[model samples]
Target: MDLNTAADAHALTPLLNCLLREVAEPAAEHGEGTHRLRGSGRLLRVRGGRRPARPELRRADGWHPLSHSELVELTSGELRRYTGVSNDELPVDMADSRATVAALLAARAQAAPPRDPYLLSEQSLVMGHPHHPAPKARGGAPAASWLPYAPEAYARFPLVFLALREDQVAEEGGPSAATAIDSLADALDGPRPPAGYRLLPAHPWQLELVGARRAVREAFADGRLLRLGGSRLPAWPTASIRTLYVPDPAADLFVKFSLDVRITNDVRRLWRHDLLTLRRTDAAAEEGFAALRRTGSDAAWLADRGYRTAGFAFEELAVLVRDGLHAHVLPGATPLLAAALAEGEPGSPLARTADPAGWWRRYLRQVVPPVLELFARHGVVLEAHLQNTLVAFDASGMPVQALFRDAEGVKLLRDLDRPAAWQRLVYCLVVNHLMEIGGALAERHPDVSPFVWPAVREEFLRYDAARGLPETAELLAASSLPAKANLLLRWTRADGAAARYLPLPNPLRD
Candidate 1:
């Protein structure tokens, strides 16, 4: 495929898969070249599976081709017909997503990827959230507004710093938060905060978007908030664009900011409720990881250490400090984003591996055990999706450890019914995380694909035998896995936090 064709294909795959999986069903396949979209009874042809699949619709003349724009038009028409409800905004968002991918492709052509495997892995998600309809949409913002901060474009910039008056500072996880922020301040070269004000860091893009708000402006005028300046050191934006990685030796921490832009399903804001209950969730995760460690598991939890923000502009101004790689990673092991492993990046161990089966086995060993142990033993449901988990590989490029992050996504058993929690766990861990990685590996080595699911089944069985959990039998026997219905969720304009799932065929079943 040529460059533009390739980029369009990369952009269209997720959109088509989402439409097919959520709103339409697959009808009789026409050998290898064509299939049918069930709702409209329109025959279609596609070249891929659930991700980045190229699609075409059949017409009276012959097999008609669909570009990204044409695909959006088709999807909109099909959804309107299927639901009897039209979403004008969704079609716009879908178009915007395609445009954003085009922009990223253009920028990537001119930019040099980071040399560090970790940074490369973090920034390599050109096509993100494979099942989401509009993964790269930037809330309809202009490309210039977000390109400088985009991870896919390999963009990195310094954070803007602010000084919030002492009384206006609202924070939780006090000691840890203060220390982490203070460390960041020490490393940054910026204007000193005035006498009564404490240092508060702001995302430059966020400041540009929300600094003119009445509350923020009033604080600046009333000596409540002061613009200190930007930091000297640049932070690398991770796959989760709102979170940034600072490679400073003095203050090594991932700083997550509240970006007002809509990314995927939600506004990328660090919401007040999540911040208020963060410590509780984090404490539970820490306890859960501790218990898992006792089982001699090498899995680790990348704690969300703390957060700092102004009381006046809490969610908008909030910043979360998460544990950095240097502290948590195993010695002599290079850590990489699990999502990047599936997506493919420069210097990926998966792509370079000579022993696909052995590598896949090591990956399963590190990723599966901890998630199961934490769920069964501590009732801590980790959102162990590919983006939330990192795998550290030893010198031979075999996965040595699995590290999970993001406390905001964690749910304790007390908060949810066992069945619901188990479903969420199965969806996030098995469907979202394992399935993607396994598919990627399979593509690289189709011969080993058949063995992959059996190995995963075996791993779960062994864990079940040791733990004696009845849920294990159910999981192994289940005909379908819970797959999050992102397309439907967005179509109905439902709250992003409210996840709805549909049954997808369970590959783990015998």
Candidate 2:
């Protein structure tokens, strides 16, 4: 397909999905693939499946097909009317999302995908967040600004190195009590800094955005900071555009840098509040995964060890160090992003399995157990959604293990009430994660699809029986699942950190 056509198809599914789920009601009288906007009481039609497509509006004369831009207009109009609110920015964001996909398609045509299956999986999400209104929007910036660093484009580049004077450094897990961030200068193999200076790696895109600030410029103008060129080797941008995977054999690690631009919900900057609580959150997650290890589960947690940033531009220049896959992944097994699997990535173990039932059983056993176990045992609520997870496949394409990351999204039991935590867990694990994966699996193997939900129920039943947890019983008894209202949230222009949920039919009960 041509880039525009492809981009339209890519962008339309998620927007249509949001509109159908959040803004529209079933127009059962009109027929299947038809829905009426609850806000406007107008009918719309879409060919539905795992990816809804080819949306049309029921006009006075007949059905009129809607183009991508027209669909964005309809969504903007519906949201504006529904909420009794006006949003000028969201419409631009929605349009920018489609434009961004077109740019990514153009770039991917010329870019070579990485040789590694893991890297390929990470870069495969051209259409991310199935329910997000504008998943691909890069803070509404022009495509040229973000295209070079896009994971979708298979982009990789050297880290821009800078020397921070020792006195000007503000670090948490480094210095007196050191983590990887302390000695990262030497490990990165960047040019040596002066006797009183420490090396800091930065995202080039971020530097460009923040370089003009008086504080940043003053540091460079004086002697507090010095530029030391880029790193010798390039790092691959992962599915999360800001976090990168450094492929160095000797000093392999994932480095997350602050990007001022917003991607999905929040600006990708590593805010100071999250930075302050990083160690605490990482420790809790580590403990939860360690408990899984004691029970003979090989699931791993990629630790977010430490971070480094200059005091002048704290959030702007902050860089976080995360654990590499070397120590965690099983031998002879390749780890693939869970999100890519949900997208029905071709030639993957999830796609290649002859016995879909068996593969799904293995996948559920590896994925479902840890999330429930951690919440029940450790009071640790992991954001166990598809993007935050990785599943490793052994030879013959059998799933052997699952590993999870993102300490910044972790929530401790002490902070929130049990009910709220449980709700978040269900939303992330059941609705967002399992539902998408099951749909993908079903799409590929329709015959055995009947057993997928049964398998999930059986696994949860087994866990509930073993642990004697009440939440499992409540979940099974509940008629609906909490689906995050991404469309509604975007329409309201609410804080991304705060999520609102709408009820979705609980597939577990099916």
Candidate 3:
């Protein structure tokens, strides 16, 4: 909370430093704006012109304003008021759960599911599509078949956390449902409860493919989903786990569940290993455009422009209760942009500001010239970031769409032989999404100074010198250690790159 004793950053630094010197200080000098504080004295007084306008019924449209009690009064309110416990404290009965079947056989003895990862009977999951549908001139009438998409009708149930308890489930039920649950623990678990038990609507993709894979265990020193939702829902505080917006009985979707198991099922198994690295980098850019079929090559010049791809199974994100017109546990679109950046107005210019030059101009117009026109017309490699990208925008704010999920993170070249699909697309887009969330946003936004890390390694060496990729300065000097560890691990990780909605500048632009 120290932006030198923040009082809304000294009441919005005098009209936010004259609106950041009228949008980026051109040699400063905007007077009339005021601020004054002197010496060991308490002269502290500041103004941003009477402010007050925020509450648009505490906003929440499109989401990304994180504020969990103003991030527990900015980071350490008694370590965010300790409220833990609840791996759904089993033994409600299933042959007495056996520690959820010995923690799912010690996480299927350290991972092994790949091979035919998920093409789900060869291509067909481009929800609400239209990639191209006019080709009839080949002798007339023969297009329009790629539109029907359905993952149980526009999927849902990704997360919905909550589960807490300590001691008293009548002194921890042990001996066969503890004597009929201590004489009907209030008609079988449901009244005057507190010193222990809560468990609300779980299902971060069934705790990552079943009650705890703590979203891919990844040890740090002997691990099997221990503590912090012990493989998926603990770390108390009245047993938190809030995110729950279920609704998608068939479509017009919505399902924003995540009482945080690293935002449910570990970011949905890191977006299913980046859609298996964009399906073997879209099948090695369709066998390098079928080896230049008649020398015209076009997997959309290598692939990335508004990239779109999807195929998720895990029993089509289960967990249902009821809600007429199709409600597969709805609510998402990042909790409506984290509830409109948590009721906007921290100097609100429609509060969704994100920088680093509109994330390198939409990763250089919808992902670096479509992976530099798929490595100069066919030798592919489209990784694209932010959980293998999604973005999607319209109503006028531009950026139309750009799905691109994982297929491990898609790479191809080495003369296209496909060395095990370019080592699982360079360990899931350079070691799990840009060096682990760009080293947690460079250890929590050290004042946003990652200077767009060498301007995205000089925009991938000017996109391999204007699209003639391959060995492009040895893959831009081996992609700067996962882009300097995701620009220093997404600035200390708890989803903060100023809470990720990104893309800015239009504060009424200039």
Q: Pick the candidate with the highest lDDT.
A: 2
TM-score of each: 0.97, 0.98, 0.22
lDDT of each: 0.87, 0.89, 0.28
Spell out the clash pairs found in candidate 1: 13-53
lDDT (10s digit) by residue, model 2, range 189-272: 546788998778888898888999999999999989899887778888999999999867766789899888878888889999
| Runs of candidate 2 exceeding 4 Å displacement | 174-179, 182-190
| Poorest 10 consecutive residues by lDDT, candidate 2 | 175-184
lDDT of 3 at 326: 21
List candidate 1 segments past 4 Å from native.
Answer: 1-3, 50-52
Candidate 1 lDDT, tens digit per residue, 440-483?
88887788988889989988998888886678889989999999
lDDT of 3 by residue, 1-510 (tens): 432223223222222222222212222132232222111111112222222211111123421332212321211221122212222211121111112222223332343321211111111111101000100011111111100111211121222332223221111213322232222222222233233443223343334333434323332123311222211111110001221222222222112122222211123232433333433555675455446434432212222111111112222222121111121111221111211111221321122335434533443353344444555566566554433443333333333233343233355566346543333344334333333233333333444445534544566567667665564455444423211122112222333222222112211111
Q: In terms of TM-score, how similar is model 1 to the real structure?
A: 0.97
In angstroms, how far off is 178's CA in candidate 1? Answer: 0.6
C-alpha RMSD by candidate, in order: 1.4, 1.5, 24.4
